[model samples]
Target chain A: MTDRLSSQFAFLDEIDRLKAIERATPIGDNSRPENSAEHSWHIAMYALVLADHAGPEVDISRVIKMLLLHDIVEIDAGDMPIHMAHDAEAHAAKEAAAAERLFGLLPADQAAEFRAIWTEFEAAESADAVFAKSLDRVQPLLQNLAVGGGSWIDYNVTMDQIDTRVGVKVNRGAPRIWQFVRARVAPFFSASR
Target chain B: MTDRLSSQFAFLDEIDRLKAIERATPIGDNSRPENSAEHSWHIAMYALVLADHAGPEVDISRVIKMLLLHDIVEIDAGDMPIHMAHDAEAHAAKEAAAAERLFGLLPADQAAEFRAIWTEFEAAESADAVFAKSLDRVQPLLQNLAVGGGSWIDYNVTMDQIDTRVGVKVNRGAPRIWQFVRARVAPFFSASR
Candidate 1:
């Protein structure tokens, strides 16, 4: 009974700590923030869809685990785009702050587990983490392209920038998916031209 | 590469299909619509913090998997609370509809694995599923008591009503946790009088 009651305390604490989605975009004319919850779901889909072309012998289950938890810290530190143009130091600070607040929600042992997964993802050194990162990058690229370069047009994004941001994602994670992106999505860049 | 990708898609599809968190609060509040993503994270904490009390040896790893994928269908069907006072048909219809849409998100085989985990949870037939469901029930009861009758106040819920709702939960899952709930939470009802 003591345990059951404590479980809820842990649950509620985590909920309170999840970061609010702050990315805003105009759908037609209205703008709204994309909360962390939505971002997590979208990334999971990218992981699911792109699982086939992952790096060799990848334990996708671990990749799924990492992807689900990696951004939870974003709830505390807040999200910054890869190109949000912050130096590594500030990036480290923001993610580090987020890591402490978010992981702190769990009991000591569980918090350690979650914190480890998040850290592993940040390093992007492991095969699983790298695969997960690829999906993270690819999902947003697909979203932007699907939205007809919605954010790209809004931000006046250039093709070179998009390539730099999402290109290596293909090189590292799944070469096939990257090729598809190039063939299917490259036309969009030229069409915009 | 293809096998890993397809496997993830299959699991994701199944997770999406399960109508895990369709349970809602008695009254309509946006909060009742707590996403599956939120519920999964909450339950993972339950699995982690309260693992010691579970009767069966809990594979924390497997428990985490179940918790993470449990209520995916809620993504499409939205959350439905347990005490909404709906007919059996209406309730079943709501969740069933949600299951179809949510699971459909994944490619194919991935959907089946997710669906099985969800089924295991709803059945309470498997050890892992039983522990997972126990945690699910435990988390919210604490929240309601912590917030001084949370949705209870909003919906004008009575002590008897909460007991009845929690009764089925207690009988089916963790006995120890159930006993604690009765002892600690019953006082809340008595003190209110």
Candidate 2:
């Protein structure tokens, strides 16, 4: 029991480094780029608070689980914002390797569970996964919208890109949030375009 | 729909300020003090991962909700470390007021739901609340223990104080974790005593 608990704690310790892994979006206050830890935290809260808007069969608890573990890979692979990534395949491969190494620190059963959650999130297939993905996309979009497209401006992100990447996921899982996104992001993207 | 969505977003924006509210304990790495946002996130993760160890009949989902919303009041009341505060009643009043104002930023339904969760955590009578409280206590204790009693040593915290304040809670909700805490923290307190 002690050894197993220590392994779990070791895994937790490794992921604490997520706090230092900065994401593309600035925090709402624009104090600095938000770290992955708080990003996961914020989206988990979003999942619970907005679960009603998700698809009918979506399990909110599962979505929250996926959100919490989704970014653990960034602890090793480092964050490559979807907007900035040049090659999706390469990024996914790197993240997969990182997930194996990081989650591997846990005891066997926990390692399998964590890796399965990460894999399920990456697949984004089920109702829960789709809703989890929506919350994930919605968080940075909210951050960008609140801060007047802080990262969007910095990275020169365009409307079509946002529509294609983020829009589809938000639309599929939580159509109401997609409506909000389209309406809210229109002005900034219009001016930029 | 737009109005309610905006209200929800407004609440989300308000809680983002939690990232700026720092706590006494450092991250596992000892890099710097952990902020309330990450602290909330870490503990929520802790609650999920350690749910099996909690007492029977505890509702894990409810406990997760409690953990996520627990420190949101800190966004307004600011973090008062358990070891430092001298007045419990004064702290509760400030936190209750803060919870009202902060959670109230959400739509009426969400505001009520959030307030209920926050209030439940404060009461700490339910099995879920007791379990949630255990994760809350264990997180900082682990952080402190990992960094060689980071906050405990700084605050000159003693074994008796920890026993009264944190040990009892951890013991009730998760006996295994309490055992780990006792074994791990014993050396530090022994040296100090």
Candidate 3:
């Protein structure tokens, strides 16, 4: 029992590092770049608040779990902003390895469960995973809009890029939410142009 | 449809303020105080990783939801440290109003659900709520221990204070976890003395 709790506490301690893994998206008011831990919290809240926007098939509880676990790999693999060009194969490999190492810190059964959820989220295969992925995309986009084109301005991101990269995934999971995003985002892109 | 989504987004933007509301406890590295939002995320993770320690009657999903929604009221009423002295009636009144205004930003149904979860968490009545409240207390204790008596030193906190204020609640919901906390924390206090 002691050993089991020790392993769990170690895992908890390690993931506290997630609080330091900074994302490109500046928080509301643009005080600083949001850390992965806080971003995870925000997107989990997004899943709760926007559950009505998800497809009927999405199980919100599972979606919330996926959102909470998704970016934890960022603690080890580092966050790759969607607009940034990177080696997809290499980053995927790094993320896979990170997931194994981080989740492996837990007891064996929990490690398997957590690693599987993280994999399911990465695959975006299930309804819950898709909705979770959509939220994962939506948060940064919302942050960008909130902070006067945050990160979009920094990365020189364009509408076409956002459409293909973020819109497609979000629309696949939640079309109504995609419509809402387009309505709010179109003006920003047009004004910037 | 747009109106519904707009209210949700507004709530999301408003709660982003939670990341700015600093807690008394510093994070693992002692670099800065942890904010309410990230602290929420960490405790939700604690619910996930420490679910086994909770009572059999506790539902982990509800506990996670409770943890996520628990501190949101702090955005409005401000965080009152457990060890600090404050007027209970005033704080509770302020927190109730905060819950109403903040969760009310969601669509009507979601607003009610989120507010209820927050209330349940505050009440700590059900098994799930009890476990959720335990994680909420457990997290700061863990953080303080990790940072070498982080907040305990600052607040001039003593062993008895922690036992009454944190341990009893954690033990009610998760005795094993409370045991783990006690074993680790004893060494810190002993050394400090």
Give the per-residue lDDT digits (tens) of candidate 1, residues A1-193: 4543564455445553452445433122123334555456546545645656776678866776677667776665677765456677877888887777666755667677878888889888888888888777755555456457756676676778867887876568777766665665688888987
- Predicted complex 3: DockQ: 0.83
Q: For all the predictions, what are the DockQ values?
A: 0.23, 0.71, 0.83
Alpha-carbon TM-score of each model against the true structure: 0.76, 0.96, 0.98
How many clashes show up per model? 25, 0, 0
Write the residue-wise lDDT of candidate 1 on B1-193 in tens digits: 4545444444443443222333432111234434455456556655655666776566666776777766665655555566566576775577667665665555566566666777777677788887787787766666676556766666666668766776566656677777766776788788875
DockQ winner: 3
> What TM-score would chain A of each candidate receive against the reference chain A?
0.84, 0.96, 0.98
Candidate RMSDs in Å, in order, are 4.9, 1.5, 1.0
Q: What lDDT would each prediction earn against the true structure?
A: 0.62, 0.86, 0.90
Fnat values, candidates in order: 0.16, 0.60, 0.74
Would you list the clashing residue pairs of candidate 2? none
Error of 2 at B30 (Å): 1.9
Error of 3 at A93 (Å): 1.2
Task: Quote the lDDT for A85 in model 1.
Answer: 60
* Model 1 lDDT at residue B140: 65
